[model samples]
Target: MATATATARAATMARGSGAADAPALMLSGVGKRYPKFELRDVSFALPRGYIMGFIGPNGAGKSTTIKIIMNMVRKSTGAVKVLGLDHVALETEVKRHVGYLGEEPHFYEEVTPAWLGGFVGKYYPTWDARLYKATLERFGIEQSKRVKTLSKGMKVKLGLALALSHRPELLILDEPTSGLDPVIRHDVLAELMSVIQDERRSVFFSTHITQDVEKVADYVTFINDGRIVISDVKDDVLARWKRVSFPLPLRPEARSASDPAGLEAGVAEARAKVEQAMRGALGRAFAAYKIDGLTFTGITCAFSEDVAREVGHLAGTRPRVLPVSLDDILVAIVRGSEAC
Candidate 1:
């Protein structure tokens, strides 16, 4: 598999497709509501020839959003456009140019890969039998293997081969690497990177694996609790967020207090003070915090010198600021949302 830096460089090289004026996929005010869960006002776009990672924890509505975009699930409110065409109004036409790989793909259990390919190939006008066979062989998938007999990784590989054989302009993959072993996952991602080499094609990758997103995505859309937390270039997002840690001052009187009520009150007061200080300095900044014994850990987007100085003053220690990974960012976002 290509290194993350190499994948990112490839994505950057493919970023200058002529269709810069319009996005490959766009969603505006997209919403879907359920009795216990909802996707609200989700909006983002994937440019032509670039890869966008759609990231979120489980039940964060990533699949719901994809289904809405595919017109498989109706949206309560929103607009979806694919290749500049309204997805609902141009469902058939949109599907012709879009290839989708579901998290759990289903096929006729008794059918062999070859039979399945032949049946599915009829629906795609641009299906290339040679390419299909080549891809299958590359993945080491046997054409005569029955769907039920194939391992989970093999099934995913078969899905990818089928999805790519038609040479679709847009590819939408949901949890493509979820259950595969590391080697298989790397192979799958490498294939995706190769696909993005075409300046006319784009990919919308939805997965919980932050490492995968960090590896190849040019743009990232992070969602949690059915809402978009952040969306921007992967590099910018990484540069803008940070992890800040500091030592918390414990009140000696509180620590020495004999009465349980008094101790609880004192500790609560100290916590309230810390929170107030943080709020005063950050002012609704995207952040999450936790107290561990005498230490305070915070994940925030305010990594500037001014913010650092302010935090140092409040904590009576120079804050330790560290660059964060996409996985850390996701955890922080989810924790911040829960804190709210």
Candidate 2:
């Protein structure tokens, strides 16, 4: 549950009660250059009062993007607006209005939560000592205990408490539950759900956990290889993408697909046949197909009854359309993109 202090503080920190037209976050043509890897033209928006899951596989620039949002890592190009204010030009004000928790939160290990709270609280002009104390108690952290002796879960709690104590209008969290157990993870997610009770604050959650995103995220932005793959409402994304499975008919062309000539050549042959069979069936629906023995499993983002019927009629096989989950969609897109 969201603590009363957090909800109350969030309202107080809001830009204004009537300022709802602007998005909570907006990134335009954001790019970060590196010798080996670069985040190219990354852009997305999290509207006010919603949780936008920034999801992708490891080394997919999720952290890099978050760091840029926080102005911890300078971008090579593009603009970032947090709470309708320029993120970089007004860095101090942006930080004051946005509470952030890094993937790996660091602190002075020698100090106790009590002492560290005092030190950190001094920076945020709106920091509430009472809320910080309440959060620590709620998370079952011993205020007097040193940071070095606490478990990972406990440390996450400590970092979250500090972030929330300031009552920021936007919360930017990076993989806070990555290594936590199910129970701890549940606690963290539950807090997120309650954070936006007033429907003014927003959360930008950066993580690889598809389950966590599916559970509480209103929107999802998928990134891979430093690029935005898809960004849209979670339900819309799930509704549009689907799994189409059909039996690979026993034929000469189909037979070569699974032959031992070479996996690459065999796979290519399988895909070609599937494409030929699905020619008129697809219409406006773009799909990617793979062969696993005698089955052809295709993933399409534009699923419809007409497409399904056409697939059955043209492919000469009964094709089943199944709703897809985030995991299914992610794998399909990544594999499909890589294959191209």
Candidate 3:
């Protein structure tokens, strides 16, 4: 009776919330290393109903981590759990629950969406024909269209439709918006947002486009140089990175002392130099903030003022305070690659 009850509980959990008590996905102390790059000690959990944005620079371990989770490549160390099932030990079951899209999606050129759908749809016992039909209709994808004949955006939509029709508990997409036009991208975004209407379903997509992540993802994980750098909500990351500038007094011994101007002239020169350096370094205007005895030089105005102050801490002198952007955070992380 106890064993039957436990089995029933597992089934109920899987049916209702993918994994109610357990996370939809969990990576604990996971690490994978190549000869020149490594993804080290990465860990996170995506509970039911949450979308996690996996962001990183090129050659960052976002793809590696996704591959590992998909069981495409075995992990060198640690563990990955999907829907409370061990990824390696339960590979077949986990795959049934995960829907994936790659940067360059491949389908046999001869296969029609109808045939491809028919073929892939056979694997899932719980595949929803009604949902699949609705998806095709909504996307205006014709069943007779050859996979190769479709545009890139259309193919992506088809992939998404395939994934959703299977009633997978989790959708994992790799660069789903890489090369599409803005209109297509917006459509795809809307399509993805619609997937979360179930609330128990989740999406984990990897991309370098912070704008998409900012717009759709509730949670974010940043990877760089083969490791997890920052993992938090989208707002939190933008809140932490900022750009700042300040003036150094003109002293004969100082780098700018060669100019005959007094401290006032030094301030102007310093402002210009600081602005130039920040623009060169950060690529945006520094948005200023209010603080006693503190001024931001070369600061452009923005919503990410907290980020500016945090970045200011690293300048060896706290110039002024302001907000930072996702782009600025990336720049700062890249600048201090060793810290990452």
- Going through the candidates in the order shown, the clash numbers are 0, 0, 15
lDDT of 2 by residue, 1-340 (tens): 5798677646644643223457889999999999999999999999999999998989989999999999889999999998777887778877887889999999899999999889998999889999999999999999999999999999998999999998877999999889999999999998888888858888999888899999999999999899998999999888888888877544555455555665556556656777676554363475466678667777788776777887787557779888878887777667653321
The residue-by-residue lDDT of candidate 1 on 1-340, one tens digit each, is 5698677646643542223346889999999999999999999988888999999999999999999999889999989988877898868767878889998999899999999889999998878899999999999999998899999999999999999988888999999999889999999989889998988799998999999999999999999999998889999888778788877654778778999887777767777778787666473444777777556787777567877887777776788888899999888777754332
Report the candidate with higher lDDT, 2 versus 3. 2
**Candidate 1 lDDT trough over 10 residues, lowest sum:** 12-21
TM-score head-to-head 1 vs 3, winner: 1
Candidate ordering by lDDT (highest first): 1, 2, 3
Which RMSD values do the candidates have, in order? 8.0, 6.9, 6.5
lDDT of each: 0.85, 0.83, 0.73
Write down the lDDT that model 1 would get: 0.85
> Mind giving the per-residue lDDT tens digits that candidate 3 earns over 205-324?
988887888888888887778777778777766655544455342333444465544545655654555445454434444333222222444334332544455445433455554565
Give candidate 2 misplaced runs (Cα > 4 Å). 1-20, 248-275, 278-287, 315-318, 338-340
Full-model lDDT, candidate 2: 0.83
TM per model? 0.83, 0.84, 0.79
lDDT of 1 at 198: 86
Model 3 scores what on Cα lDDT?
0.73
